[model samples]
Target chain A: MADFNASDLTCLRGERLVFGGLSFAAKSGDAIMLRGRNGAGKSSLLRVMAGLLAPRSGALCWNGENIADDRAAHQSRLQYLGHQDAIKPVLSVRDNLRLWGQLRGVSQLDAVIDAALHALDIHHLARITGRYLSSGQKRRTALARILIGQSDLWLLDEPTVGLDRESCAELSQLIADFRATGGIVIYSTHIDLDVKNPNILDLDDFAIPMVEWLTEHADLNDDTNDSANMQHSVSPQEAVQ
Target chain B: MSGFMAVLQRDLRLALRQGADSVMVVAFFIVTTTLFPFGVGPEANILARIASGVIWVSALLAAMLSLERIFQADFEDGTLELLALSPVSMEMLVLGKVLAHWLTTGLPLIIAAPLMAVMLNMDQSGFVTLMIAMLLGTPALSLIGAIGAALILGARRGGVLVSLLVLPLYIPILIFGAGAVEAAQLGMSATEHLQIMGAILLLTLAATPFATAHAVRLAIE
Candidate 1:
């Protein structure tokens, strides 16, 4: 069983501190529901987990090995679904799915792709180009990608934004199946998800306070924004335990 | 290797399906090159003298026209983030993209340059040198331009921004490429100029993928 952990994660975006003092851990078959309002750093935390964004101060590890040390291995083991639906306008749905499978070095894609397409209920739209797909269809296509390749972890950012009710139900079913197969899913969504016994991570609890953000920005002008000073600025009492 | 090929093949297929993007780039090269004679007058001696510079400059601009789309389309639609997350190193995926760009934009420019050379009253002796020079030079344009393309991934008016960012860097290729034909026309060996262009191509080939990949990573962040 794989173990994923994040400790003392602090994220800075531009001149603003998005989040500070965040930590979480997951094991095989674990489902994590990241809860936060818009702009509460849900997406940033997800990106950090996917290794797409480096935290200002934190370490992400899988099975006790630092993910940063072996990025390719980390990347190979996870699938990330960002806010944008990555479908190419000119390519048909099947070709798009096949293209990603090929990218993952999945040589025998015919059966896997067909199964993924079926899982998302997009088998009928396989021949249609992405330009003609509705937002719901496009979201389904993007979600279907998570199943095309073998991955132990999934980092989905606002995955259900454009999905319809039926498609959302299909996604929940897919997530349940994925967890049953020893996969760990960490997803952020506003809608209720049906996954069992999910570890709920409330990002609001980790959000860097506005007053602290202002002080940090104020430090930028003083040229004293070094990590030493920044750490001191966060009162020991407020830091996450 | 399969990851690289996957990106390359997918990009090539997209280029083929769109079909017009490549055609428009070639057409822009042709149309832009054809205007030189009308602007400078059809004097054979002058046209012949200016053909190398004119063709190279037009090719540079034509190549620039297509640069923004190299990474911008993927960046916008979010394919770049996924590509970055894939097991393949960003450098390899970037190289695949640069090759696809060269095949679609640079290759067509090379093929169409000879026709423009003939129309500009270029010396017959310089024709082969011009084709050879472009063959050695255009890939470098795509390579260097990929850096600019990747840089301008989220910028406003990125097409214009790419030209401004990439044109200065393209000057070396422009000089050597045009100079090769000029040297050949003067009955001198164009090998030295060709070699310099080849070196520049190899340098960009080795370096730009990494640079572009880094820029792509920053844009994704």
Candidate 2:
């Protein structure tokens, strides 16, 4: 059984604080849904969990050990699906999925690949090159990539976008099956999904309010105690000017 | 190692499927080298004198032309993000991409350089040295160019920016690579120049993977 936790995570994107004092934890067989309006740090949080973006402050722990201490072990157990489908226009759907699996050092590749494609209902479109696939098909292809590897955690950012209702249902079923197998999932999306007993984290709650952000900006503008503030936040635009 | 091979195979497959990318690079190398003869007038001695320099420069530019493709497509398609998250280290992934790049872009340029050398009336003695030098030098071009490609990711005018960023770093390779052929033509041993080019290649090979991987992580961030 694996335990994943993020505590006091503060993330800065460019100069803006995407989120602060944000924390979440998930154990085996848990599904966490990240919900908030647009620009509410949902994707940033996902990226932070995936260890792609280093949070300015805080730590992510897997099985009570900080992930930063062993990035390779952390990476081995997680799969992250971002906004892009990662489909190469020149490769067929099947080849595209296999490339990811192979890169992850997945074994029994043929069986895993076929099963994933079938599960995603893209088996018929497997031979189709990425350039010819519709957005829905592309998203399905990307989803299928998550199934071929032995990942204990899945971090999906807007995994439901461009998916049809049927495809969404398929994804929900996949999530259910993954949970049943004791895998953990954390995902962000705008649409209603049929994930069972998801622990919802509204990013709006963790977002620094506009008033506080404005005051911080004002404080910076006033050059009051520059050293303390400069270490925490230096927006690229500010540095340029 | 399997991950590295997978990336290499996938990239080669993509290059083969696209069909036109390597061809365009080779054609650009050929056309650019051919123009030198026309511009300088077809005097054999003069053409011979400048042949090594022209071929090395053209090869450098051709390699740079394809540098953006090394990571641009992967970055845009989000493959890079997933790759960074995968079990394979980012450094291994960068190396895999650099190898595939050399195979598709560098190998072809090596094969084509001989034809251009002949056209430019290069001294017969310089031909083998030209091939050897490019074999040593082009991988460095691809390696150094990888850093540039990764740096310019998500930037505007990345193609132009990659050349500007990598071309200055390319000067040392150009000096050693062209110097090798010129030395061979002048009846001096080209080994010292070739050895230095090899050192550059090895240093770039060891260093660029980490640098390019770091740049790529930043680009993703």
Best by DockQ: 1
lDDT score, residue B123, model 1? Answer: 90
Worst 10 residues of 2 chain A by lDDT: A228-237
List model 1 lDDT by residue over A1-241, tens digit each.
9999989999989867788989999999999999988888999999999999999888999999999999999999999999999999889999998878988888689889899999998899989999999998999999999898889999988889988888888888999898999999999998887778899999889987866665665445344556556567666746764
| C-alpha TM-scores of all predictions | 0.94, 0.94
lDDT of 2 by residue, B181-213 (tens): 999999999999999999999999888899999
In model 2, what is the error at residue A198, expressed in angstroms? Answer: 1.1
I-RMSD for candidate 1: 0.7
Model 1, residue pairs in steric clash: none
State which docking tier applies to candidate 1: high
Score residue B44 of candidate 1 by CA lDDT: 96
lDDT of 1 by residue, B1-221 (tens): 99889989999999999999999999999999988888999999999999999999999999999987688888888899999999999999999998999999999999998888889988999989999999999999999999999998888888788888999999999999999999999999999999999999899988888899999999999
- List residue ranges in candidate 1 displaced over 4 A: A213-241
